[model samples]
Target: MTELGYRHGEQHTPPPARRVTDVAVERFEHVFEVDPRLMTVHVAQQLFPNWDTLRIAAGRADHLDWMHRHWAHTVVSGQELLDDITGADADGPPGGP
Candidate 1:
């Protein structure tokens, strides 16, 4: 028997739950055409003010740490934003062009 009362060979595994960051990344990428993995803190703060508020209210330190790790090493540029806004060619950089 398992913790959930299932037999040893009949344990049921639940489907993986999507993380909040995953959804945020997907939406941010879809709208901005940028790899959200490379988003800067300023950009993330601007784009996800609601998420920030929720994190603070919920006291989700883990989520806050995950967000920091998500955008730890990259910076967004003006030219990249312009390219995305103007529908320019897609050859600028890893996250945008």
Candidate 2:
């Protein structure tokens, strides 16, 4: 009879622990509601490709510093466009006038 190599009691490396920040918690509350495991370190890294742990823990992180660098420009552009629309509306003649 051939011996089996697989063991049912084998132990595996545990996943890294996650400590979500207040900002992340607030923004991702709904994500947590839907998937409580979304706050894991691995998931955070996957979602935020360019995140810098050092910066986050050191309190020197900028608004967009630890975010995915690829999305930075897109977010900024969108915000700028929104601001432009707001400004245009504010400058236009009053609707009831």
Candidate 3:
């Protein structure tokens, strides 16, 4: 018997549970041109805290690539926060002031 208290000849393996998360992480790669799996979840979360879209929007070209790969249009803000396609350093908060 193991820690799970499984007896001999008995398959104690539990079934695979659904991947549930409340932090709202991106799951799909919208940019089909590029491979999404290239970036791992750890790196994504590390580079982008809470999978923040603003970081991706204001980051380098590669970061932008990550954004698209993670389904930017759906996972994050649903293509609503994109105010300026052109990356510009503006004062005050994003889309404000």
Best by lDDT: 1
Kindly give the stretch of ten consecutive residues in candidate 2 with the minimal lDDT sum.
25-34
User: Each candidate: RMSD to true structure?
Assistant: 15.1, 13.0, 15.9
Tell me how candidate 1 scores on lDDT.
0.47
TM-score of each: 0.17, 0.20, 0.16
Q: What TM-score should be assigned to candidate 3?
A: 0.16
Question: How many clashing residue pairs appear in each of the predictions shown?
Answer: 0, 0, 1
Q: In candidate 2, what are the lDDT values of residues 5-80, reduced to their tens digit?
A: 6443332321233445533332222222223355565545233211233334345435456674645554456788
Residues 1-97, candidate 3, lDDT per residue (tens digit)? 6487535333332222233343223332321111224456645523223234333444665776797888666545535456443333454555765
- Residue 3's lDDT within candidate 3 is 81
Off by over 4 Å in 1: 1-65, 77-97
Better of 2 and 3 by TM-score: 2
lDDT of each: 0.47, 0.44, 0.41
TM-score of 2: 0.20
Q: Candidate 1, after superposition: displacement of residue 16 in Å?
A: 36
Residue-level lDDT tens digits of model 1 in 9-97? 32232222333553342222122224445576657523434344344545655775677689767656789888786664545544652
